[model samples]
Target chain A: MSAEAPPAEETIASPRPVRGSLPRRLVGRPELGAVVGAVAVFVFFSVVADAFLQWSSFSTVLYASSTIGIMAVPVALLMIGGEFDLSTGVLVTSSALISSMFSYQMTANVWVGVGVSLLATLAIGFFNGYLLVRTNLPSFIITLGTFLILQGCNLGFTKLISDTVSTKSISDMEGFPSARKVFASHLTIGDVEVQITVLWWFALIALATWILLRTRAGNWIFAVGGAKEAARAVGVPVERTKIGLYLGVALAAWISGQHLLFNYDVVQSGEGVGNELLYIIAAVIGGCLLTGGYGSAVGAAVGAFIFGMTNKGIVYAQWGADWFKFFLGAMLLLATLLNWWVRKRAEESK
Target chain B: MSTSRTSKASQTSPASRKALVALSDISKYYGNVKALDGVSLEVHAGEITCVLGDNGAGKSTLIKIVAGLHQHDGGTFAIEGEETRLGSPREALDRGIATVYQDLAVVPLMPVWRNFFLGSEIHKGRGPLRRLDVEEMRTTTHRELLRMGIDLRDVDQPIGTLSGGQRQCVAIARAVHFGAKVLILDEPTAALGVKQSGVVLKYVAAARDAGLGVVLITHNPHHAYLVGDRFVLLKRGAMAGSHAKDGIALEELTRQMAGGSELEQLSHELARTPAPDLSGGVAKG
Candidate 1:
């Protein structure tokens, strides 16, 4: 023991100190709580519901998570950069409505509508960002205004064009099959089939994580979120960073929109009224602060995963579906507390 | 730091010791309010130009003019003796005029290394795939801080955890690292403790030694006299006096900063109060 002690001391003393201790690194991760929460939720469901561990059940959960995860990833980044887009939910429905209605009314290929919808959704995002930056208004008010405007337009435009609250089905239109194959196709693994959206979700998570951790733009996002004035003084291009974040949300909405359009063939104008709250809930559950400047994409993904589990876990446990919101609220609160505790521990460790 | 000196020397002849930034009779107005009027000063290379003023003496207005946050309505501002008009902070930065405001322009919650490379992050790769060179930034930040005589336990720690003076020093170091020819520091030590202010002053001196022209704006004459080579005093949005280190004494500078007789009158009142306290309280005891 005495002979070995010298070598151990040499190892500790010979080199420069490591960047951070292992415990410190683990504690510093914003998503540590979300990861723990996800694992606990997964394990709880697996134990209570025999079928919950099955491949089919897993695929179902993945698909459910994928839709919200697509939007949650960008929303997380936006939140980290210190802003919110309350209009995201309605924007998704609006995208779908635009594509479906335009295809049917113009007797055009479904792809044309999809393309046009992308532009329109991006314009909406730009409008939100532009107004927020130009007027110096709180993002809450700016995005809320956008949310209301989009909600009204989604209903008004659908009714004006189709004489109904939902757009006409575009399933039989040209390019429908190809669009469906790309946006709503299923991937077979063993005997279970999972949605293309699940793949999109994973891909986006990977991309957002890379951008947040390994890119200069990621630095700008964190800086802008933490302190806008400071970022600008340091030449962070605050306006462009914010506008770009909003545009990211817009692009994700387009993907979700396409998936919704091709999967269901029609879009109800009011289909996405409350979904924005779900996205925000998933982000918060993942470890994003309501005040911004601290969060991670992977945390948000884990958050959506937890959301997906709870949504299905209740049904699998033979509990009433009405318990979903109750569990979601509970999980959100628990995750936030865990995150705050973890952050405190990280700070204290230093 | 060695590289910074070489660059400055290449741009300007050392024999002449020219001013990097010079403002002559600069004035600004907002409607009926004259924010600044007839202020002139020169920031020479490898020296500190201390701008001292009381509250509402146009210290911030003068800083804004040089930082290019606001344009001067009259008179001329020059860079390297070339007359110029700066439209925005970006243009000012392009002209090598960087300002570190009292706020420091640093995201407190961000890691030290991240905050160090906040806006001007170095990247590798090509096109849209370009990623931050994190290892290089970390190493460079570590090296630069060492050059500034700061040894952090961890660069990964959020900058918010640093003391006010350490943060100020970091901002000054950041400005120096970014190739700032003339640095405008706005009341960096206003909220710091004695020790922290000392730490910041050490860096201000270090920055001056690094061959960069530094503008140290403060209301404290003691702080100014310690490192300033030239002092520019402002009163009522106008220049009260400008003096070289050899031309003025600390007491004289302090008197002018307190509005001449206004300070004497206040001191007289304080002296009378002390006399009453000493005689009545001590005699009764």
Candidate 2:
């Protein structure tokens, strides 16, 4: 039944590896469990909860996840490219505070402060990448050091400036009147209202997806992550690809910083802590391997959606809000098991 | 193996047909250990130049030099008869050279079509909207692999899903599609079973037929004897000898590789000398 027509091809043709199978559906993959679990959760929430189906509640989740979602996209890409950036969480806080202080304390224009924040974040990222490539150390170890240093700096400087752990309002700045609209604006569609950052979230996700699956750079990311030595053998620039991934992660953090600023209108010293690992969790749940190579930007975004849905869905179901952390832990464990199975099956089938 | 004969390129081909790759007196140093010492050889177009060496014979070092993974501490490396520098693999690829290293050159998780166009993907848009031409890549990979006698029913499969031999072919086919004028293969069939080795050997012949200057580096003289136009022997960080196809017989090649001359001498001494007679004194008693 599976036989090919002899006349169809001029020659017998070499057999290239193929991944899809229509009939079996599983195709020897292990991730079927997590996929099924996620679907079940979504369906249950949509059907049972009163506020779960409401547009505004959904928007609220999206708004909350937008920051996490943006960071998760690049983290997924970097994970696929075979690296991680631990400094991102603290860097976001540092960037936002820096921007807020520049605009309010130093009386600079909002855009200028935003620009400085982005530039500074990029510098940190580049340094992380530079040391990583040159020293040939795993990015995890290097970025961890950066993470600690940044955390200390964030606390130390915040305490020095105000004699307290938080910075005063950037909302009082002269330029804050016009600056609020670009970032803190709200969008309403029918009965749904979303923070304008959702638009940025969507645009960034779309752009990141394009870069991962549709460009030459995307191919390099896969090659480098798959096997860096082999990639170098075939003329892919391993160091450059790795550095670019770090740069991408840093850029994402900077954007997240901007979102947090516009959302809260105040900077907190302790904000965004523990969030870098959260982004990594989202990427892993999205099917990215911890070792790198073989993942999807779309999958990571979907992962963020799952997180968002559950966060709001639990409240809408009138479940105790204290159970949120437990739910996330369970979800992560399920995803990890599914992903491991899928990889093993993939190896066996090959 | 004896069924083939060289199709002599006519005088009109070029003035003194260029050496597709050349290493003149190339030497490598690893913390005072001379890995390669004054190693020199030339690879020509329309010919398969095989480098045969045993373990630690500088074969790995030489191939790394040609592939642009390592730099020579002492030597003049040239391509197309002109001296040139290849500081990075990207530079080598830019100049139409490609290397297929054993293991890991082909990404396991990426689809066959994607791996085929990796690092040089075709795009559809002019500016901000630019995106990979996925359909084009998928069909072209199918077509190219088909030409090399590899056709997958679906081009969307992860390359890791194929057998080792098939994966090597995909890497080979990728180089050919990307316009690699000179292709260097490092131990392409080292870890294969009999059937897989046969598949890979066929692909090597196919690559040569496609007009690529082929450099086959292997420790197996038998594998080299199959399609090689010329063979260069390396031993202990230096060139031992070189022979054209007509100059060396299969037995001689094996004998050389097996250290036949040294073995013969040991036997000769063993046969000529035995028991010089403290036994003779005992016989008088």
Query: Please, what is the whole-model Cα lDDT of each candidate in the order they appear?
Result: 0.87, 0.80
Q: Candidate 1: what's its TM-score on chain B? A: 0.89
Cα lDDT tens digits, model 1, A8-125, are 1222322221388887888888899999999999999999999899888888998899989999999999999899889999999988988888889899998999999999999989
Writing each residue's lDDT as its tens digit, candidate 1 over B129-149 gives: 789988888877876776677
What fraction of the true interface contacts does model 2 reproduce?
0.53
Instruction: Report iRMS values in order.
Output: 9.4, 5.6
How large a fraction of the reference contact set does each model reproduce? Answer: 0.46, 0.53
Docking quality class, candidate 1? acceptable
Full-model lDDT, candidate 1: 0.87
Q: What is the lDDT of candidate 2?
A: 0.80
- Residues A233-255 of candidate 2 have per-residue lDDT tens digits of 66677889889988998888888
- Give the candidate number with the greatest TM-score: 1
